[model samples]
Target: MSRVLVVEDESAIAELISINLRHAGYEVTIAATSDQAQFEVDRVLPDLVVLDWMLPGQSGLALAKRWRSTARTRELPVIMLTARAEEADKIAGLDAGADDYLVKPFSTNELLARIRAVLRRKAPEALDALVDVGGLKLDPATRRVTRDDREVRIGPTEFRLLHFFMTHPERVHSRAQLLDRVWGDHVFIEERTVDVHVKRLREALEPVNCARMIETVRGAGYRLTQQVQALSN
Candidate 1:
């Protein structure tokens, strides 16, 4: 399920959007202020953000610009939501890096449609395209992984896990996050399952000298990093 962050100060409007989004099978998180929104984003990157123009601390426009300038959130999809209907205001919102803009008193149906469109636009195409990170290569079309002309034999679960990690390289992903993203959320697998698969994935990559690419982030979960070097024992 895609996760969406709704940053709206109005209690009724936020709750209404949250309800509709949840009904549509999206994981929804509510933030009443820009600070809270930033806090949530810092905790875990959401698939998309529904941002309000005006907030108690800082305007959503500023927040959008900040996110756009940041490397981690540069490609984060955002739909600006506000009472402003002026053409200039809309342009400013887009300039601040909003993917789409929605004026208040908006139709919930339209909002949902726009959300779907934006997600479709921003999501990485995993089935057809080939993903390359550092020297590691994953071809979804062939379901193959190779490094330095050597093939890395991995299981189905490990293949999916590596694909996700390669696509979102350098970012920490908790076991729960990995499960939700890699394995379907409908699956009731234990978090320990991730550890087991990760170990197997590393073992498969070991033959290709790529096992060091996957790093455990201490208290965090796992990260696929491009800085692959043999660690000292």
Candidate 2:
């Protein structure tokens, strides 16, 4: 059974979510504050976290940022719940590294679906096994990437972006497609944000001279090429 952490300040809402998740055959843990949530996360790493935007002490956005900075919970999927329905609020949540966002008064079915999707993406699967493109190797199990015989250190987002490109090599993918495939469909982020991460990914690959592997298609999108190009003399 997948383990989930529910971080909400309201005792009633927390209990409601916990009971519903438990009924859905998931192991659930509830924390009423950011400090408690962090402690629970350290004690037992959850497959997914349902975080409330408003908390007593530290806000959920701050907690999410903390998780992104911590190596152990960096890649852990998080779903942010907030009463704020503005586009700015959604963008802020996504920018803070939330895997998904849910506004208040959300349906139980929708919440359950979001939880399942996030957990499915995070769950260890065969697709996450080692993948090799040309001489480059990406091992999701070890969260390591290597070119030839050398190891490469990449940021969490960059790693996911590279994995997506490698798995779908030779095909042009639009920014929207990349966002859906990598950031999850439930995540609301600017399409331009994809450009930012692509730049970061290229920077990570620069030391290995593999930066050119990601090709920009002008107005279209991006493509991953394994064929080496000749240097202009």
Find the candidate with the highest TM-score and give its number: 1
The per-model lDDT (C-alpha) reads 0.89, 0.85
lDDT, residue 197, model 2: 95
Cα lDDT tens digits for candidate 2, 120-189: 7765552677777666789988999988678887999999999988765555788988989889975769
Candidate 1 TM-score to native = 0.72
Give the 10-residue window scoring lowest on summed lDDT in candidate 2.
224-233
Candidate whose lDDT is highest: 1
For every candidate in turn, the CA RMSD to the true structure comes to 4.7, 16.0
Can you list the residue pairs that collide in candidate 1? none
Instruction: Evaluate model 2: give its TM-score.
Output: 0.56
User: Per-residue alpha-carbon lDDT of model 1 for 1-233, expressed as tens digits?
Assistant: 67899999999999999999999999899999999999998776788899999999899999999999986677789999989999999999999999999999999899999999998876656446788877789999899998877888899999999999977777688999998989977577999999999999999988877888899999989998766544511
lDDT score, candidate 1: 0.89
How much is 52 displaced in model 2, in angstroms? 0.3
TM-score of each: 0.72, 0.56
